[model samples]
Target: MKSHSLDLKSELLAANAMLRTVIDENPNIILMKDWDGKFLIGNRALADLYGTTPENLVGKDDGAFNPNTEQVDFFLKNVRSIMSQTETQVVLEESTNTTTGEVSYYQSIKKPITTADGKKQILVIANDVTELKRVQKRLEESERRLNYVLDATREGIWDWDIPTGIVTHNHRWCVIAGLDDNYLSHPLETFVGLLHPDDSADVKERLQSCLAGTAPYRSEHRICLENGSVFWVLDRGDVVERNDEGVPLRMVGSFVEVNDRKKTEQALAMQSQLLNAIFELSPDGFVSFDEARRVSYVSPAFKRMTGIDFSQVNGLDEVAFTDILVDLCLPTGKFRGFDALRKKRVTDKSGGREFIEVVHGGKRILEVGLRSSEASMVSQILYFRDVTHESEVDQMKSEFLSTAAHELRTPMASIYGFAEVLLTQELDAESSKEFLSIIFKQSGLMASILNELLDLARIEARRGKDFVFEVAHVQALIEETVHGFKQPSWREAPKLVLPVESLYIKADQKKVQQAFLNVLSNAYKYSTATSQVTIELITTPFAAGVGRRIGIRFIDQGIGMTPAQLERVFERFYRADTSGNIPGTGLGMSIVKEIIELHDGEIELSSNAGVGTTVTLWLPLIG
Candidate 1:
């Protein structure tokens, strides 16, 4: 009996030590319940959680601490479940207090506790999961909202598991594809089969490219519905996940029906193409100019006629080609020659005439006359023919007439000689002197007419002459030209203005001087006697990629030409109605244009009928 009592004491001590360790080390709310649902043992955690001590909790019904009826019932149910199964386990939800009136969530599990003699009690283990449960509820709400939005918008959402070729579609996605709920479970190929046959290959290629990571997965294609109707859909997707090797593992995307919008766009594109065709195919040259007189559009005929490509000429100001027109017109100051030809509405005939002279392959050619429309305020269309041969023939006719007049003058001279011999026999000294003076004057007039005819012929034939290029000081050129014009021959004295210093330009000196002289002379001749012809020399920067250029402007308060006259001012032999009896060869402006162009510079002319005219020149500045 003594040995048995010692053994019993040792066993009891060990049990107490084990219980103490569990109470100290266990984080859970450990407790023991009897078959009557009375708490027999409780750990420190359980006591603290329930606002009681372990000793106070002993032999107390759970109702002593767990005041909540649902919690008590839950505990009882778990205890009963464990006891009935002899080792059954169950989870129970319970609320416990941490501070006054502060409740927390907990999950409790109870299991059967077997005694050494095989009788059963209950052991319950509880864990805190309040924060976890709250987070879970939040996530569920967010998902619900997202799903509601997608459904409301009718966007067909889908997910694809690339490795397994499995696709899941939302209800709307299935409905859009003319499928039922089972569509989510179907193979992805099922949807591909619904694509229009003509688009199937392209769709497959795009999808494969996306899967291979070569391109983004996006496409619009027509889908054939169950009822044999078709609709266009815009599908967009990107890989959402990748494997270790960077291969696509999953993709999520959405589809939207765009049949109506696509159809409308197609129709509009067709109409635009039709309009463009009509504009391109029209026989007449079509052009549009902006307010700045820059060429906005030019048709094919315009390009062909001018030997200027639209691509090269577009965006260039109309005044930029003043030199080109002048070269063609080959005009004198008073009557400039034609520069180009155009077909005119001459009593229903489509005949064209050439205007100006042009150099082609080192030979001069004249452009025939052509009709032009004067409807546009800043632009005109010209139609003309090549009249180089015809002009030559006309020149030959003039030379023949001059020769005939010269031959007739000799016979008349002989008659005058014999008549003079008869008159000398009977005339007084004063009368003889007068008769001889008259005869000399008539001979001089004939000589002057012959000289003018020869000069005209030479000018017509020499239209294709090559120009000598040289570096010329633009400011000095103007000053020199103005100084020369200061001769008493000029009816009106004009004011000459120069830049502060000399500015050099790349051009032929003589030709440029001639051009300057012509313009100044015109200004002086046309201006009111009291009004000053302001020759202003100003320079400003131009866009030259690396640096800037110098621009020169000449402003004059002269008798400016009307719009009708300005339009034809650059034409060969073209003189304004106001230029009547003006002592000028219309070719002066034409030559000015040619010289400036040979220097690769630009000139612009702007004038109002009564206001004045402003001529601006742009030339590259020397380094």
Candidate 2:
């Protein structure tokens, strides 16, 4: 009996030794809890982690270390799940602290522990994952930001496996081709097939060069889509890895759609061609100079007319030409001793001088006239014409017109005023009516001729001044102007349509009224008796200085002018037909143009001879 008792004690001692060895060697935290959730056994690692000996921890509930009841409840829930066979293994994230107050992340797992007699307990294992969690979070954040940048810039990302010819593309790459995410794992041949036939060879060659390590893999090519549309693509990539034989093993690249940029380049190329044509074919000599007066560009005609070689004169400053001209003028007070040159006047020689003259080239003498744009205090553009023949003709015409106008104005005014007075006097009723009609018609004819002469004089003398602007109701102005044209002699009164109520516009009221009346009268005279005349008022918004602005549009429909008539419609006294059949002085449109411009507004006319005409007037709406 003594020997048997000693043997049993030794077996128990051996079992305890094995359990201690197992617990100490465990990489994870190992602990045992009783049914009441008290720590009954703890490994050396768990004891060391809590800064306590295993003996002291054995009888303590989790409150001794974890402290928080919530934490204890969480732990108990997992223990109960394992004990009830609801879960064979459970994982949870828990926060814990060592004696140093340093926070740590732990991935805790719980499992059921049963005694040989089948009484259940809880076994908990915890793995430290603080550094791993931090690294994972950082990686996820980096990926998110990278995706954001790619999305914002509309960049397409791709990866190519050189060995297998398998291509993987991100969603954006598909979107760029007007597709969806259904072709990510498509073969490289699928991409190659989409390339324009003309661009395919160059692209393949570039790829081959990259694979052979002979060049960087970058290229631009035109790509065709399934929808029969084409786009430009900028492909860029690098070799990610290489085999011992120097062949690329893996490659990565991006596809950026550059179709818009390509279109812009093509448009610029066309514009350059147009400019080149203009420079080569233009009759007038065109030149541009920098602020320093160095000639930057000159048309082909300029080179021919000056007899100065471009290579020798390209960078020559305008000061050099001015100095030469000044020297010539000082000696002869003329350009090469020409009489007309001597008669030229310089208003403010500080800017420059422009006049007509005859210049003598060494081989041939040519007549040249110069009229300059308003130059800055330092720079000028001198446009010249060969006007030797035109000057003589203009002088003769000017003298004849001056004499003729003086003689015609006196008789025309008397004919117009005297007839009006005689027609208004008493006479027999039948004779009175007939005579009045004749007088009225003759007076209108005379007035029309006088008005045309006056308009011609105004244009020749440049007598118009800027308009006076004021706030006025456009609706009221329109009504007044239309009322003035309401005479009873017409076959039928034209229809007047005003769609909207009163609208306020910022413009010169008198000038606006005159313009509206001219347009309305023209429409009435040209249209059939039954034709309708519509005037529409529309408003729109525009941007102003740190605020908003309103724009008013006046649209009209009536008998339209022909294309040729429209072209010269605004020229003073320029009648479309001069047969004296159309009752117009021809000065109305010209005056209308001058007034509208003075008010800083715009007028546009669209017309078809038979269909109808529409005049659109735009004026600012002011408060």
Candidate 3:
């Protein structure tokens, strides 16, 4: 009996030792509280949490260990509820600070148990979950930030579960699609239905390609809204979540409205096409330069005018290109350097326009204008127009005014001097009559000059509008003009020789007769008394093409002009006879030239000083 009692005590000692080991080795805090919330049993883990030994914690309430009133109250309340059988078990979370000021979180479980003394005790179990809760809070904050960013951008966000065909989209997605909010959680088909019919197949194809791992999910397509309006969206996405087999299980993307940008691009394309057409078809020349001053465009007219093919010089720098232009068009001693001109134009605050004289195949005048606007490539545009004919007309006007002024002075001097001589003289009837007759003749001469000047002016003022044109025989016109020239006492009547019976021509008959009459008058005016003037009409073919011309030749043995005088005879107010003996205005030959040019014919005059003079007028023949 003594040996059995000793063995029982050893077994009890071993059981207590095993229980202590189990309690100390467990990671959870295990403890028991009486129904009144006082500690009755405490394990090593529980004592460690309270910063005390298990024996010190016995019979103590939560007030001894936890300074937080709310925590202590919560602990007592959970224990009391379990002890009263109001709850089978209580599970809760609590946070506390340790002695080292480190925060700790705990998940606690409490259950009621009946002791051998018939009193109820609450068993408590706690596990530390501070790190897990910290991580969870961080994930929540990150998700909130992501949502804020998506909302701030005002972009539609979408997530698709490929396997389930379920689509999840934010509120903004519904707004962009012009649909109700219920569409946010709809199937993928609902979203797909909003796509424009023309773009639906392409969108699906791109999506399928991405799913098949052939391409990334990115596309631009149009979507139709409920209001029957279409909007352009730039959709970009990638397979953010994938299965182990590289299959796309989910897709995330954003829908950005690209309608404005698309419209702008299309408008720019159309403008470019229109500008290209203008460049090809415009009659004037156009050359554009980028900010870098390289040749950006060259028009067809520019190519034709310069004979410098644009294809060969398209990329040439401005300096080199300007040099080529200067070499080709700038005449010696006339125009300034291109660089200086260009710099002046650029610096001028006023509208940058420049006029220049260029010697192309002949002489040419060009007007260059520079234009820049914000909408341009921030580039400079150069426009060129040829004004050579205008320039020549201006020069002719200047010369005509100077000559007319000089010619009027000579006639005025004669009239003024003769009239003064008659007014200041005291004489008999014969002398008075002689002086009056002289004055009357000079007055007649002045009247003739003024009438001729007026005639020429009127003809010029109304170019061909007042002229009556008709078809007439050239031979008859020449005969009538020659017959009207009266024989001078010094010269014989001119003989008319006709090579053809009838040479027909389209002409202003009255003007043609006036022109031929002027030619015959000049022949008689310059020839001597014994000289015989010959007028002959002949017809010839044009050398340039299949055309015919009738020629009228006036041959005279007269006081012909020298080479220098002959050159100036056709100039207004320039006479071949500077000796003041010839009774004629220099305007006759100039008028003859003008009339012939108006008829689209040419007048040629060849003369020798002592020999005879030959003047031939050529006119286009009628059919």
TM-score of each: 0.30, 0.34, 0.51
In terms of TM-score, which candidate is strongest? 3
Write the residue-wise lDDT of candidate 1 on 176-252 in tens digits. 88788878766778878899998999998998888888878899898999898887788889888998999889988
Model 1 misplacement above 4 A? 1-466, 486-492, 544-552
Model 3 earns a TM-score of 0.51
Backbone clash numbers for all candidates listed: 46, 0, 1
Q: Candidate 3 on 316-427: residue-level lDDT in tens? A: 7767777777776665423343455567667886445567666657666776665442223324556675656556766877887777777777767776876787788777
Q: Report the candidate with higher lDDT, 1 versus 2.
A: 1
* Runs in model 3 lying further than 4 Å from the true structure: 1-284, 301-350, 423-446, 458-463, 489-491, 541-546
Cα lDDT for residue 370, candidate 2:
32
Q: Rank the candidates by lDDT, best first.
A: 3, 1, 2
Instruction: Please give the lDDT score at residue 25 for candidate 2.
Output: 36
Distance from true position, residue 172, model 2, in Å?
A: 84
Clashes of 2: 0
